[model samples]
Target: MTSTDAVPTTAPAPTEAPSSGIPDLWFELPPGFLEFDLEEDSEERMVRMADAVDPLFADATPEQKLSLVVSGEYILQTMIAGGAEHVSACLLRMSDGKLSQATLCVIIERPDVGPESQDRRGTARRTAVQWHEQHPDAEVALIMLPYGPSALCIRDQGLQLPGVLFGLDDPIPTTIRQVQFCVPLRTGPGSALFLFMTEDIEHWAEYLDVVSGIMKSVSADEPDGDSKPAADNPDAGGTESQA
Candidate 1:
């Protein structure tokens, strides 16, 4: 579950687009977050990257182009924040030897809608209900964290998913616990970043604290020279096993 084991692959070939001269963003990671090296060639990686951009571009209106571009920037910055080529993830090992994971993503709202038009809490509760229905064996609850009102924190039990890039057949614990949080950027509609943490139920308080720290430490500033870069080897590593 540590960052040291990530096997990086060659960076994907950059696509040719109009050069607006806006340098790409690289977000700063909070202390103790481990970035899983996401291979560039994985199907899951491609799906995630596509998810970040595709939805924003679909059925586009002439005036929506600028919003789409800004939304894409938020998605890209979020990808960098979690140290992922496409989808970002950070794993933590708790004191009880249980594994905890945080999967990060960005969701861009449609351009025509006002940010306040949507009901975040109601939507989040419905999401929680859907997750519970998907995993009947797990306990589920909607929660509020210190990360402010725009954040959605959902606690669930017995539902363990592998890393974002790990395929369906990847070995994982038969049972798992997770806390998923979605925090909308203050930039209004077409911008929000989220993180989900999976860990043992016993470590609920601890994981909550960890996510809180992450929310507090997140920044869009460029990383320092001393900051660690994403994993660069080309090997596919196994997911961290649950203890």
Candidate 2:
């Protein structure tokens, strides 16, 4: 569940076109809220990366991709939503213990009509901006863990996942006592990058930064489906861990 265990395989051999979802290098400074400019030709990259995710991409049915948009939002309401329209529930790993927390949402979709859409990334960003206006009280940030990271780590690290990622084999938990939101983005000096509060903020950011970097590096190899992490990973957290 920790960063140490989430490292993806190293980069694949070079090829034509932007085969990798991540760029060649990522800086090692502030952690967590990873942001990057959207490439004009990013749709293919998005599909490629999404397609490479473990089971989701391997034998993914068209129906599943359309449904994984809000896996946990409906579940974590009272504990962590902090008054927002769209929320993401996460299992936070704090220095001491777990806590339930929620983060605002940014839903993106593909502009082009394809079974594998690329514009979903943009849809999410635009929605986030709109969400911020609707609820002036919530904190929001954009930190996209590469598809490989999201698919591989969310379950193993016990992080609560959105509907888009949940599966029938991955049954939803019936009850939950605690949750935590881990947002490692630092907006500015003394400012919260992810809008929620938690300890080890920068340290968490370091985790995201490093993870993002690694995924980006390995994104090109047409992600393989090695043995996934065991389910004992306990990947079910609440709103308390996301902002």
Candidate 3:
């Protein structure tokens, strides 16, 4: 497939962040990458991301799981509850051979609770919406949150999606198609990845391959190939969980 050795993962590495570089796990970047690092947990791999998802599938058999290493409350509190900070989001497309399944990913830093309180979730949605709008040729929705609870919510919601999300009252906490995964950030930040269009499941592997390619290219462009742990502070939080 075709790819470029450009751009970079946004979140900088914190003390607890891993330095192994792109991991050998199921998800990976492409081969032509010059520099890249893989941690056990990536923020772009969360659940709330699904809120941004649109009509990507008819019905998907979702998987169930949980990550208690760092409770969502704890992560949120540790970061946001502690004070103010910046968060980053990402947009990804799962290539389904001829068609493409688009997804949006996000990474929140010091996420106890940000200034965008009323529109906290909106912050992420807006970012994803803008990306899709800018690239109308691409798919819509499919949002992801690098935060922990968002990941938990991804699996929680993905399993009961489609019909269960009609009420405008609650407004579908997870409007996008999202999935939760473990990240290597301190306390291993939680991550969410939303998958728009259940039809893409038939071509999941191929689409994932495209994602892997992009990830590799991003890593290759990293200045150090990977983020190293901080010497002064061992539990320095999630610095590399950038984007």
Q: Where does model 3 exceed 4 Å of error?
A: 1-97, 109-177, 186-199, 212-221, 224-243
Residues 1-243, model 1: lDDT tens digits: 132222232222111112433212223344333233344434454355445434433443433333223333343445555643334444344566434444444333334676455444554466567667876665556654332233343645443334232334663443434544443222332223354434345666776665555444333222332322212222111121111
The sequence of per-residue lDDT tens digits that candidate 2 reaches over residues 83-179 is 2222222223333432222222222111234322323234345445655575455444443443211211121122333333454555443322221
Alpha carbon deviation, residue 192, candidate 1 (Å): 1.5
Off by over 4 Å in 1: 1-28, 36-39, 43-86, 96-102, 114-148, 157-176, 191-193, 219-243
Task: Estimate every model's Cα lDDT from 0 to 1.
Answer: 0.40, 0.28, 0.29
Distance from true location, Cα of 140 in model 1, Å: 10
Order of models, best lDDT first: 1, 3, 2
Question: Of the candidates shown, which would achieve the greatest lDDT relative to the real structure?
Answer: 1
lDDT of 3 by residue, 29-137 (tens): 2322111122213343334323222223213222211111112212233333333121222223334323322332323233454232323234345545565565554
Count clashes in each candidate, considering only residues at least 3 apart in sequence or on different chains.
1, 36, 60
Alpha-carbon shift of residue 196 in model 3 (angstroms): 8.4
What lDDT is obtained when candidate 3 is compared to the true structure? 0.29
